[model samples]
Target: MQVLMRPWGAMHYRIDGPEDGLPVVFANSLGTDLRLWDAVLPLLPGIRAIRYDKRGHGLSDSGGPVSIADLAEDAAALIEATGGPAVFVGLSIGGMIGQALAARRPELLRALVLSNTAPRMGAPEIWAARIAAVRAGGVASIADAVMERWFAPPFRTTPALHPWRNMLARCDAQGYIAACEAIAAADLTEAAASLRLPALVIAGDQDGSSPPDLVRGTADLIPGADFHVIPGAGHLPCVETPAAWAALLAPFLQDHAR
Candidate 1:
């Protein structure tokens, strides 16, 4: 575990594996923090894995409104703070941030593995309503709402994933709301064409939040980006189908590692 002081605030992060190995960074989903990668981390070996929370989420100090660029900058800062230019693995808003970073600061990225997110997160009005609800009612109001979109229908019926469902609902509402604003305002369609990084776009077959078609659209925009769909998974593929996600990512990272 590590705490990094950025221009905005102190960002809490976790680092694993030998320092000499290839670096792999993870940018998590909106409501959840670095802890969300627990299942996937063990699957990735021979790499220094990095995971951190966005400002206002998790143990990181809360700050004012944040932009998608701010999220990218924070990611770059984390890289510089811990030996960067890593193969980036991102989910949801994290994927959006990774797109921006890959476009604007290509030098900071070795490769990109994006899950359950798109280049330009369209449908802003829906996100606007979601932000309003989180800000007004706090994260608790959206716990079940997130669960519906985040996991497969069968996972919801399992007792093991229940605690995580409640935890998602209990996430910091302000952080979720602020991150929601970042997603609503971001547009990276033009940037996708310029990306030369080795990239993978993986989507969940049953994910309503970021459906397979949306990920396909993202793949079409980014040059040479590979696309895959995980069976029986939703938005949170790392939790619902960690093994499949790990299998898809391992070779991609191994092929790109310096």
Candidate 2:
């Protein structure tokens, strides 16, 4: 584990595989940390993988006010720390940050994998309300609310997923609210459209958090972006269906790595 402190965020990351291998940076969703990639990492091969906690989450320090661009700067700083440009793979808030990074730091990205997220996540009022609730009552207040949106009906009721749902409840409230603020203020539709990097957008068929239409709209806005939807799973598709997520992502990364 290596920790890199940048102006905007602190990156606590794990680097694996040979230094010479194509580098791939994995950014986790809001509220969760790099541990979110635990299931997907072993299924992946052929690249140097880097998974990190964003500012305000997990082991990383909660930096100052966070914006989508601020998050992007964190990614850029992480790339510089990793020795140079690398492929960026992100989910939810992480995906929005990826779009911003690719737009502002094109020289630092070889490719992108945007999963379970949107360039411009609509409904700011909803975000604001959620943020306010978390600030007032903590993550426990928002946990069940989030779970309903993250997992589909069947998985929501599954006994196996209960612990995961409880884990969601334990996330830091400040981190959750800050991330929501970042997402609410974000509108990267034009930024994504302007990117020249090869990109892939993976959505979940049953995800209400960042539904298929939201992701499709983002892909439609971005020129020449590849889009795929994971069947049956919801927002955390990578967790629920790791193999399927890897199958969609691995080839895109392989094709784009230079």
Candidate 3:
């Protein structure tokens, strides 16, 4: 349970593997914490895996107002603190952060992995409606809908689904809304297009939030980005099908390890 005290607030983070191993920084999705990568980390050995609870998530502080750039700055500071020029893997809004980070501080990253996300997630109207719902009834009000988008039908029926639902329900509403505000205002299409680095774009075939075509389109934006789709998975493939996710990620990590 390590914490980095940033100028804004405290950030909860953890580092695994050897001190001198290749650094792989993982930025989690909107509602999930560092534990989002728990199942995927063990599958890829011999590398330092750095994961943190983003502002407004997990044990991190919920500061007032945030944007993709603000989140990217936090990521940059974390990477510098832990030592960087590492491979960065980001999911959902984390992917958006990766886009912003690569554009802002290209030297901080060796490669980029964008998973189940897009440069622009949803329309402002849609985010506004979601914000209204959360304000009206809290995150629990949308937990069921979020779960459906997060997991495939088969996984939804299993008891394993309950914990994830609870995770979403228990998240700070103010933080959740702040993230929604960031997502609403973010449109990284131009930044993603200008990127010139080793990049991999991944999508869960059944991802309702960022569909395969949308994720693939993001891949197309970057020059020479490898794109792949994980079958039978939803928004969070690394969580839903970690082995398959690691199989795709291990080789990328190997190729770019510094």
Write down the TM-score of every candidate: 0.97, 0.95, 0.99
Global lDDT scores for all candidate models: 0.86, 0.84, 0.94
lDDT score for candidate 3 against the true structure:
0.94
Order the numbered candidates by TM-score, best leading.
Answer: 3, 1, 2
In terms of lDDT, the poorest run of 10 residues in model 1 is: 165-174
Report the lDDT tens digits of candidate 3 across residue range 1-258.
Answer: 899888779999999999999999999998888889989999999999999999999999998689999999999999999998889999999999999999999999999999998899989999999999999999999999999899999999999899899999999999999999999999999999999999999999989899999999899999999999999999999989999999999999999985
Lowest summed lDDT over 10 consecutive residues: which window, candidate 2? 5-14
Top candidate, metric lDDT: 3
For candidate 3, give the lDDT of residue 158. Answer: 96
Local error of candidate 3 at 252, Å?
Answer: 0.4
lDDT of 2 by residue, 94-164 (tens): 89999999999999988988998887775899888887888788888877878888888888887867767
Candidate 1 vs candidate 2: the lDDT winner is: 1
Where does candidate 2 clash, by residue pair? none
Give lDDT: candidate 1, residue 13: 93
Candidates 2 and 3, the one with greater lDDT: 3
List candidate 3 stretches off by more than 4 Å. Answer: none
Ranking by lDDT: 3, 1, 2
